[model samples]
Target: MATGWAGDNAVQDQIDATVEDAVKRARSQLNQGPSLTHCEECAAPIPTARRQAVPGVRLCVGCQEVRDQQAAFSGYNRRGSKDSQLR
Candidate 1:
């Protein structure tokens, strides 16, 4: 039941933290105002289905997919501490 230096339930804790951060980020974006009917980056029109499906989608399906993929690949040092940073 102990995970030593990693701490107990370290993996689960990291996952929960990531999910919570993501949810908070998404919610903040929603509070910014209504979603536009078109992608800001591109002139492409945002489909009605997408706007209704996602509360505050700023990008179209294609752009959203790319952003999601990039986010998933980005890494964060969850185990890093202030002491570690100093070193």
Candidate 2:
């Protein structure tokens, strides 16, 4: 049973919404249009194999790896559970 004013399915609904947001975020990060022959950030040559494998790739493997490492996740706390707040 849900406590307070939340419905029985409120927890599940919140989980679903959070998952949907993550999926949308991932999709938005995908590059569009034609793949560039050179990396946009480092100007390094983009290999034909990478360009063919990933359509519309803009950065070389090294640059892409760095960019991925720099990516941050949203800090929004959808779950108000005590355990979640501890983290």
Candidate 3:
């Protein structure tokens, strides 16, 4: 049921949007050209295991973690619908 403001489904919609964004990002990253032998952040060697596990990976494990965290914090602009604009 709706509460004081947005309905209960509003939170569900936000979750769905977040998942969609994550999937889209993962797909684009997978389609990247190639993996780099060395990490761009610390110049550490990118292990073969990581390269094989994550296709088109560019950063080392440590660097990748940091980058991923940064990306997660950078919220998406999920406002393409006309209904959203009406608000």
Candidate 4:
């Protein structure tokens, strides 16, 4: 059932789009070749366990944590409406 002005499949379409976007984003993050032995950011040695776990890991644990924190703060509300934008 359509809940809004779009159509009967609008909600399902949105859901499918969201899932597709997430899958694309995740696939983009995968390493293409060999894992780096050192952290690219801090030049620290990446642990063997991490390299084995992540496959093509770049940054060490500490640098990766910092990068993750920075990313967390940079996110935006992608679903914001035009009405909300005006406010």
Estimated TM-score for each candidate? 0.53, 0.68, 0.52, 0.69
Tens digit per residue, CA lDDT, model 4, 1-87:
755477779799999999999999989987777889988898989889989999778889999898889878844655579876555
- Sort the candidates on lDDT, descending order: 2, 4, 3, 1
TM-score order, best first, reads 4, 2, 1, 3
Tell me the deviation in Å of residue 9 in model 4. Answer: 3.7
1-87: candidate 2 lDDT, tens digit per residue = 746698889899999999999999989978898999999999999999999999999999999898777775556887979999888
- The numbered model that scores best in lDDT is 2
TM-score of 2: 0.68
Quote model 4's TM-score: 0.69
Q: How far is candidate 4 from the true structure (C-alpha RMSD, Å)?
A: 4.5
Comparing 2 and 4 by TM-score, which wins? Answer: 4
Task: Look at candidate 2 and give me any clashing residue pairs.
Answer: none
Instruction: In candidate 1, list every pair of residues with a backbone clash.
Output: none
Between candidates 3 and 4, the one scoring higher on TM-score is: 4
Minimal lDDT window, size 10, model 4: 71-80
Cα displacement (angstroms), candidate 4, residue 52, comes to 0.4
lDDT for position 25 in model 3: 89
Clashes of 3: 0
Error of 3 at 50 (Å): 0.7
- CA lDDT, candidate 2, residue 10: 87
Prediction 4 global C-alpha lDDT: 0.85
